[model samples]
Target: MKQTMTNLKQLIRAGRGIVPAHTVIVNGNLVNVMTSEIYKADVAIYEDTIVAVGEVKDYIGEDTKVIDADNKYLVPGLIDGHIHSECSKLSITSFAKAVVPCGTTSMISDLDEYISVSGLEGLNEIFEEVKASPLKVFWGAPYKTPYTFPQSTVSYNFTKEVHENVQKWPECFGVWETVREAVTEEDENTLGAIVEASKNRLPVFGCAPMARGKELNGYLCSGVRLDHESYDHEEVVEKMRKGMHMLIRESSVTHFLKENIRAVTEVNPYLARRVSFCTDDVTATDVLEKGHLDNLVRLAIKEGVEPMTAIQMATINSAEAYRIDHLVGSISPGRIADILFVDDINTFNVEKVITNGKLVAENGRLSYELRAPKRSSVLTSQLKCKKTTKEDFEYKVDIKDGKAKVLSMNVKGPFVRKRRDVVLDVKDGIVQPDINKDVLMVSVLERFGRNGNKSLAFCSGWKLKKGAMASSAAPDDNNIIVMGADAEDMSIAVNHLIENGGGQVVVADGKVMEFLPLPVGGIASDLEPAEIARLENIINKAANELGCELPEPLMYMFFLPITAIPDYAITDVGPVDCIALDTFDPILELMEN
Candidate 1:
């Protein structure tokens, strides 16, 4: 409180011309996001707040630091409206180190992936660690966990206890993407949580892909203010027309920003203010190779949006969507001194980054030190489960006949939203998968030390000629999900993950080929960003050799169990028809022939 009062007094004195400014940035073409104008101006800062803009010669003093922008573009530091830091496969400190130099000064992250394995205690630890970083990190409370009962091992139902706890946290900006089940089913617990967040004046982020007309209206009427899951230009324009903020997303798994930005340039350019850019999930390799939010801004410009408008989408527009424009999103009086120096507006190449009136990164290098926080013992021990055997992955047929019908998971592309029915020969009371027809066995085992529940089903589209792959980073639940043509290799892959605590593993011919261990909460690693990228590359290469066909094989494989997306997904309970929000039996009874 004392420090806040002192800062306020300092700002007042600097603004009233009674005191000299602590720093002054002179002779830069300021990209004013509020007015969508670019003009030569001088920005003066006192402590951590921008005290003045335009003419600030009177505020300069003997001790004030002056930085000549040299006729370059001075834009507000970029903000990622929605991201999952855990997806980077690095700790919060390392993740900050990787993106700060790319001009990303602030982010609103979802802890749902980490919370799925470690629970609320892990979430609090991550929140505190991010708070101590030089970059600004905001929180979005996880709304969907253990998505369905008996299917997911860890149950976080947004009860009264969870609601009260999240509301009291100062870092929480809103509730993260609410699932369709809660809205359609009108679950009292989830709806009550949404009401509580709304009463506290926090926005609710939602996920509704391919929803149109009445379905979209029902979702919007349920109090969801923002969406990042629109798949096409039509969906983007329609959602924006109905007053929903759309976050155009481009990430390792999917790329929709180019297509969605067309909605602004072709259909409704006036609605650009309601559109923003976000990398919902990115890997360390991608950040190092392609860049962070800077990549999104550059792509938007290349796609024909004006550079200034694209910058606004990445900065002020996102801030307004989250109701944080008053605190950030522009270079105005009383806002934090988060600024970026760009060589050219067309290229969006960030040369330097300043946050909170301090130089944090220059010339693609960080100026400050980043320290990884010590994790708790319980959170570190995330892969607590028994070893598996080939017998555990076997599926016994319930039919006494020669052949049985089964529902097989089909994957035409990276996204697993479609399934088909197949008939398999039943031999000796057991149904075996037919790899010749691209049908492979998939399983999810409980690893949270709860009841050792396991579910099995058949899937296509992996295109794996031979071998198996297993990962504990399954979306939403973080369970050990493994797929293989041979049951023995599947057992080897699952056991490898169990021994390594948690990670991605590839096995062929019952031998462990490659593995990347993620010890932090079973999803994140404490390793350096470069090393993580290197290890991931090796894992992907090994997976390619084993016949996996997807571009980012692990990323697509991890989301196969995400029941929130659409159509179908597999979980510990059974195969879920996501559109209907109910579980279905994997087996099908064949007609008498």
Candidate 2:
């Protein structure tokens, strides 16, 4: 059957829109975020798309279902241009069920989390599940991934031995190296992958620090078009000047750069049109604890952005950046019948939400069908860590008698530093850190099962109880990471995690107190948003009880391997000195010199 909208059928169709179903939204001020215009009108829907929007006297018909807006605001559907569908901490269907109630009608995801644990087939399966949702979810490929990113744990490709991997490489013409060199950009595969996406006439996203002037230009020269990693105003100006649409991001790893955005807004008001809002990665708890794209809209308004302008950034700017403005960014005919009922632009709140000409949420409560997605590749992907030796987690350091100096990177969320050194105590082969001294060991194990790929480095933060504490952002289906105090509790956590397949867990006193079983890609769950939040509290309290303080325990868990931002990030490869833009050999070397 032809797509109800041509696009949906060609991609992932969830049935179709029932046409000519009479529905009148009367007595509302419709704000067209695209043209930055607002007018009093009564909108009419004839199926899944809006038929007309103006005065209702001209839209009268028998058997029409009239919704008295009671003079509420009717704007276009809120669309998040870039997101990690995995961030919902729910399966596609469960995710859709949660966000639909928040006035989020459509979302575009990088699918990085799924791909990291599954593969292309896994991504395709997710697309199929997202297809069956009430909200619209579009798929975009990721630009950069952690060393853990390639999904080798599932079906990743980096070898010339694999026919499928080799087939995808001839598509490359220039240097498109790994995400490792966002500065030098030496990999040709990156360009080839993006060009392949462009060849398919799809909007692909680019990932780079955007601080390297020449590298930024080269990335644009490749097929990648949009960028969501502008960390500074200087970078944003350069990108906009070079005609790149910048996605102002507030991810779990990076929040909106306050001074940077403020400075940009002060200098050039016109640049606002080129800027859009995106949440790269967030947990399900943050969804309830904070909000979705709505948070970005609120922040922009508070940061001196005109409320209408903020709406334009999140709605029109986003749609236009990805070339979908005509479809969901504004109140127009032939567009999906998605609208947000807001009482005020400032201090935005979801009063009601209508999607596909149907009311699914009223005052943040679900009013329609929302269920778990049918998963096709849940635990099918696995990496045999049978090769991982216990020695892989152990390291030896020579102590020069009385005192020893060790190198470390203080963990302050996602940002890393290149600071040369610090001092520590050396005992029992491992260099022990003084907890009162505020120093600790941070490590990233190659759960990809590669021998000698484990990275161990020192970082400051996490004051655990009487045991050892650890956390892993490992995106492997078999990835079971334990975070807690003491060896016995850690063992208990690991056993519990293995029992549950794989997911994030927190342990204490030899018991599996709490865990979020992510059997699906080992990144997200098939649970409700509220359920994720409830279990997440156990983690937060565990952190607090042990004195592991930062902010949100799980919310702050995103920084272990973010290479783009400046943080002493450790990966399966090693401790990356980001500011220096190089890997530290035996991390202690940095501290000694």
lDDT of each: 0.83, 0.61
lDDT tens digits, residues 432-477, model 1?
7787787888998878877888888888877777888999887778
| Alpha carbon lDDT at 80, candidate 2 | 76
| RMSD vs true structure, all candidates | 2.1, 5.2
> Per-prediction count of colliding residue pairs?
0, 13
Per-residue accuracy of model 2 over 269-294 as CA lDDT, tens digit each:
88888788877666676677567777
**TM-score for each candidate, following the candidate numbering:** 0.95, 0.84
The 10-residue segment with the lowest total lDDT in model 1: 149-158
Pairs that collide, model 1: none
